[model samples]
Target: MENLESENTPNPRNPKKPKVVIVMGATGAGKSKLAIDLASYFPIEIINADSMQVYKGLDVLTNKVPLEEQKGVPHHLMGIISPNVEFTSKDFRDSAIQIIDDIISRNRLPVIVGGTNYYIQALVSPFLFDDLIEEMDDCCLKESIGDKELEYKFASGNDNCNVDYQRLKEIDPDAANRIHPNDFRKINQYLGLYARSGLLPSKLFQGQKWGRTDNFKYDCCFVCVDASLHVLDHYVEERVDCMINAGLLHEVYDIYSLNADYTRGLRQAIGVREFEDFLGFYLDKDYNADTERIILSTEDKMSKENLKALLESDNIPHKDLLMESINRLKANTKRLVRRQKRMLNRLQALFGWDLHYVDSTESLLGNSYDSWPRQVVEPSVDLIRSFLHEDNCTVPTKIPNAVASQILDKRDLWTQHVCEPCGNRILRGAYEWEQHKKGRGHRKRMLSLKKSKQYLVDKEAEAVT
Candidate 1:
């Protein structure tokens, strides 16, 4: 319910160090536009903090700023890495800090913006990697290194430990289950943390000072672009429609031809992998990462009529498939938005005074400042200017209970299952899940599962007889 609130923290904006503005928001909350609009008020270059946007290609799925929309403002870290390479949060922190320093040297502002909560959190806060990397440098902390040089010490870390994802599960099941079994890099990190430091990765991470990491020390403020849940849901659908209109299918197909691994890097982008079923349905896939993934059916050779008939014969409606992709994408995006809201709340709880909130509900469809009323936009811009020009600025800090309740005590929300026979609605909590099980729809699924099992058993018996 509070309007234009900010937190006053210990961070003092020094003239020597460059001022950085971090824009935090969910997928469709217009973060990019806000960062660009700040250029009108101050000299600013954007440093992208989104994980997917770090990779090259699949721009549509990443919601990258198209050339026309960039408005000639210089941006860094967007569409820069190969899709096949695994880019981690530590890599982002190191690279972004260097870039921020460089921008400050040139007397220009560096603004960190995007949807990846972890990436933004790492860059804006005291990151776990800073401690880990520093500890690695200190031969005193790690006995296994035993006076060995920094570069050579961790050279054979994986081989020496022979640790894998399973070991991580034994040590830290909570962290392991959240990560994919195939994410060996993170698994190794967790394993290394435990082996060298005698600390759980999860505990080390939580115990670190959030938002004020020692290595990445820059005077910064967080501007969160937020909206009502209903409004964000609407914008997500609109953005998806725009992506569809902008040839998202062809974009994914283009990356597919590159044989990018979905389990790693940019190919893991939401829209890219979600359309795999549709792409696999239409096109022949020889998509091995080590080999070329060429499209066998060229547009010139494959007639629309022929493709339609083949899918029809297979009982797969092209229109229906597209709709299903759209719907699934919407669901995933909305879930992401919800998670983002909660993560931002974490920032508020930790860095209470440094975070600021800007209501973007009204500015959904238009450019940043122009879309907002003069009253709101002017003061907001002034607040930012004061941060940039002055040492510190004071603004009211407010956290609505409604926002806090949105994410409180809901760790298992994502793991909850939906009742497929009961309209496939998501069960968000244990109570909802229990209620669904007791409801007619869940009972129907139970009956269906039972019947299917019985039918299989009967068929086997008949074969034996």
Candidate 2:
């Protein structure tokens, strides 16, 4: 095995934008491992960008790098926030900037590792809506005609979200049509911004140059750790099973609340929401004292085995529900992995992100200790090394003509499609709209509509004859 090391020590404090290395990928792609491996060669700190992992608990469920696995590297923003607080991208950007600055001052390379691409996007791009809003002076924001009345109506409206959305459409059709109608927070934000700035939110957004390479806040070397779909599916299922064995259920049980909101904070994590049904049923069941004791006992392998035996003996239906929730957790996580991969591709193509690819399919599938460093880690370290030492301050990966030809057009990228045939599901961007059209449900809906139309036409012809 080669002694992996960073060839060039970066003087990020000098003229060019302070360099930051971003490791992003789908779940179970080993992004965290790759980032941590950089520590062997460079003085590095890991800044976790995983949305779920930032919450205070659910370590097993979130698959946070166990402290031992982190290789004694300083990791920031992992399990630090209150699980109840809805941490926004703005919060991440603000916190990350401070951390990045601090890391640079200390001359340690900051390696951002996670599956949450939006958080990475917020950090790199300057056109974040919140960031833009913060720059405007209070005096520059004045009340326009009917602004107060519109605000009052929206504030006092009887939960009529449609009315507020309609008002947004009247004022800024482009903005209103770009977002989902049910996204009340976004609708409210658009309305408020328009009222304060005396301009359409869409208009205000113009010339912000979102996703433009030139507008990046830092010299970032983006590395995407990827694997084949089959490999990822297999790996994710195994990971979920491993998490369950590692007391994932116990963590979920710890936070199980009858009225917990799944859309908020840590509850939004895949594992936590899936077990709600089973946990709800288990609590309501009239189990024996021994079974209850086993359930409440420390969640170890023995306790799990005892609980399983007890459930099997009692002929309780809870076992099936438990299995169902576990299956759901696995399925949802796989879907999430696919979505994350798609977003990374979109970032590369539409947003012109120069993502250096690291294929971990072999390492993941074979589970070879040697192949991981040789194939994945060595390439990544080389890329980061070149990025730091090179005059361009970037890894020299050429953008393909296909991606380069993709014009940086936010209007097209943000174009919204409401698939009425598919229950009026809102899909943002042309890529998502295309994907939605290719879905089985959408095709089935389209076929049903066609058959209904043909039936009506035939009946009308018969009546005419």
Candidate 3:
């Protein structure tokens, strides 16, 4: 590996904490722009930590930095996996470690960049995720649930897993009792493990990586880029507009069609699975490829003729369906922003050592938002370089605002978010969150917020002093 001295050094004998750099933030906090710019000035090659961008295609929706913008810097692990395949956190950690070590050996700074926070944690803190979750199917049960049915049950997200919980209790009561009836996700895993491996997740991991062994195989500094919430929402809205203008709907349709109703692994990408309603609208019905094209065109803002045809053919207004997709995309993204903020909080709580934050709100709200300036990238790059040259304290547990952390924690009502601006409106989910932002009351509050210049404290950052 390169002889670059990292700020946070582990035990000399530990091979885990290799020197590396990381850039992370919410959905539209300019992580890509800053990363590419840093690469321009330093000997850095970006190794993607984003789960969605690792898949091929859907560049616009994923908000991938374009080649022309990269300015000839090499980026690894981006758009390489097939969207049809399941790419887990483990897949990323394995692939990225190999790529990072390779870059270091080439005398280049290996920079891990993306919104996927878990991947970053896995890199710097070994077994960052719960060790019980198996990376691949290890259980060998005689009778297993079919994939489609399993997917349906999981996706349904109801509290109907009580029976499975009961069955699991008889077989593996420890694991079953640990999971809640409503948490089908955990229940399914517990039941599935016992059915296949005749053991609980904890028991199955007899010798595998589990618990804190201090074996993180890389040394890294996480650059958390952020903006005020009001500022971020505007940026997100602008990106959504750019996505729409850049044929986002068509991209979703193309990938959705290509996957042909088998939306696995990559379906979690922001916009893909959100199109469930539109896709399900035609699931049982069949149409030729050409007819499918005409129907899809109706959703395109540019397809005037298709719009006319849609109005004439279906009793429901084409505008309504298209708006449904648009509304969904927007709301889901806002919730993503919220969730990402929470992830940042968790990171702050767990590994506060040598973690630096770059708040570029004023710059992002500058006369030109997309135009990169020194303010955005220089400080972060300098900090990273400093990490290479200086000795920094190991990650600490001194949480900034423990009290605020408790208050800011989200209490979702069946995956919901509450917006205080609009009649204390309860946003049922992402679609409602996005639409609420654009609604009269929310926009009115946004303008008020901008005028007041009362920057919304990053809800998650409340964990910090």
**251-280 in candidate 3: lDDT tens per residue?**
776666533443256666888876656644
Between candidates 1 and 2, the one scoring higher on lDDT is 2
Model 2: lowest-lDDT 10 consecutive positions: 1-10
Across 122-144, the per-residue lDDT of candidate 1 in tens digits comes to 66666556457566656555876
* Best by the TM-score measure: 2
Candidate 3, poorest ten consecutive residues by summed lDDT? 205-214
Model 1 — TM-score against the truth? Answer: 0.71
lDDT per residue (tens digit) for residues 1-465 in model 2: 222133223455655667888999999988988888888887888999999999899999998888988879999999999999989888998999999988877767888998888899899988788755555434545533456646644563538778888888888888987887877768877776766667778766765677667789988888889999889999988988788778787788778876577768999898887988887766533335554432332432233344334335654677788888989998999899889988987787677788888899999988677889888999988888777767453454556645465545432655677898878888877777877788888999999999999999999999999
- The C-alpha stretches of model 2 lying farther than 4 A from their native spots are 1-14, 143-173, 180-182, 285-316, 367-369, 393-398, 401-406, 409-411, 418-425, 434-465
Answer with 1 or 2, whichever has the higher TM-score: 2
